[model samples]
Target: MKFISWNVNGFRALQRKMDVFAWLQETGADAFCIQETKLHQDQVQFDTPGYFQYWNDAVRKGYSGTAIVTKNEPLNVTYGMGIEEHDQEGRLITLEYENYFLITVYTPNAKRDLTRLGYRLEWGAAFTKYIKGLDQIKPVIFCGDLNVAHQEIDLTYPKNNNGNSGFTQQERDDFTTLLDNGFVDSYRSLYPEQTGAYSWWSFQFNARQRNIGWRIDYFVTSERLKRKIVDARILRDVIGSDHCPVELELSEYYGRHAGR
Candidate 1:
């Protein structure tokens, strides 16, 4: 099975900039999970013929939102973590297939001033619990913009950016905690020591041109699915938003017939 996850920044903006449907056809992924859609469902009229679409729009118009377009229809679709406070932003969506649960999440940012750090941490803990619960039932594959660089190796200049919103010790520790709870970061699992591979770049100071970026986007799965991960790639060359798409290819053997 193949999947592509991207923080498109904004779906409408991306569509206006390029042919999104053509791009989707070009990728040929079984599923395309998107974050930061920044629009309500009715606002956009995107027609993807071969894919089923699921969208979770934020209460606030043109703000935080998520969507998934998939060639295979899920057995069930769930929006949010069942927590009202955290659900308002439409930051999460879970699709249940015959074998596993796939989730797309847009983790809240700590903000430039770190004002939302406390709330971000709170959300992190709640998110951890939510995914863990799903893991207990079946292996989970979750991907999207996690909004934090997990370690010093994840970003361009760790020392220089230390304590910043996405690089803070607390935020990083929270990510570690999530991985510690029976999950694996698929890309790191594949390329443990690989460097200069990134998913998101700053729009300022020619960061993308200089390749000064962070691997805040990811495809994470239950530890049991680690071996099935055929390839996890950061498609740095693909451009539409400040963030690029991360692709994950799983062994075809682990499809519907794969037992829990």
Candidate 2:
């Protein structure tokens, strides 16, 4: 199955800039997830041909949000992490398919100079705990703009960005702890030493033109689903938002594993 994820920056903005429906049809994706929608349900229409859509809009409209558009309906769907404090932003959504739990998350950004680092650190810990809790039940297929570059190789100006919000030591360490808990970065699993593979570019200083960006968007799956990974891709050619779409092609069937 082909599953894809992209941080559209803003749902309405992207819809205006490009034909999102056309692109989805071209990809033939079974499931499509998006982040940073920056819209509430009232501001937009949730219609897309051949797809059942689900959304988690932030309590604060025109801010962070997430959505899942799938060809097949889920057995069950969940919004946020079930923690009131974290649920306010609508940053997470989980779709329980027959064999796996597909989680789409938009992790909180640490902000410039780590101003929000404290809260983000707490979020990282809680988020990791949350994922581990899911891992215990079934191998997971999770993706989104996690907002952190886990290693030096993940961004262009790594040395200069060492202590920056997205590349900070604390944030990186927390992400490492998440991987340590059994999630594997699916793209890196196939292209281990590949470079210049980025998903999010800055709107500042010609970052996109120079390809100076971070590989923050990801398709991370539990180790148990390792063999199901057929391919992972970065859709740099597609355009609309500063972020690009990342995809994962898996062999795991909907009901063969932990499907409901």
Candidate 3:
């Protein structure tokens, strides 16, 4: 099975520039998850013929949001973490399949000067607890723009960027706690020594052109599903937003070890 995750940055803006449906078809993914949609259900209209679309739109218009377009319908779909404090921005969506739970999250970004850093950390703790609960029931496949670099190798000039919003010590430690709780960072697990493999780039100073980017987007699976992951990749060539898509391919029909 194939799955792809991308942070469109702004769904409407991307649609105006390129054919999203055509691109989605070309990938032939069983599921495609997106973050930073920046749209509410009423703000835009998009459809995929064979896919079941699920959306979690922020209460605040033109802000953070998430969605999943999957060919396979989920048994259940959940929006947000169920905490009143955390659900307002519509940052998470959980789709429960027969074998596993698929979660797409748009983690809160710590604003410039670390203004939102405290809230970001709180959200991380709540998110970790939520995913851990799912892990107990079944292995989970979670992906999206987590908004943190996690390590020095994850971004260009990490030394200079250290303590910045996305590379802060607090954020990285929170990410560590999540991984310690039985999840595998799929891409890093596959290419631990690989560098310049980034998914999100800044629009400033021609950052994307220079490949000065951060590997903040991710596909993390329960450690038990490690063997089933055939490939995890950064799709740097495909473009519409500042971030490109990331992909994961799993062995076919591994039902027993697959979904929930």
TM-score of each: 0.98, 0.96, 0.97
lDDT of each: 0.95, 0.90, 0.92
Residue-level lDDT tens digits of model 1 in 84-183: 9999999999999888999999999999999999999999999999999999998999999999999888999999999999999999999999999999
| Candidate whose TM-score is highest | 1
Candidate 3, 111-199: lDDT as tens digits: 98899999999999999999999999988999999999988999998999989999999999999999999999999999999999899
Off by over 4 Å in 2: 252-260
RMSD of 3: 1.3
Q: 102-191, model 2: which lDDT tens digit per residue?
A: 989999998896788998988878889988998898778899999999888899999998899899989899988999999899998999
Question: Between the candidate structures 1 and 3, which one is better when assessed by TM-score?
Answer: 1
Q: List runs of model 1 lying over 4 Å from the truth.
A: none
How does model 2 fare in lDDT?
Answer: 0.90
Worst 10 residues of 3 by lDDT: 251-260
Off by over 4 Å in 3: 255-260
Model 2 lowest lDDT segment of ten: 251-260
Distance from true location, Cα of 192 in model 2, Å:
1.3
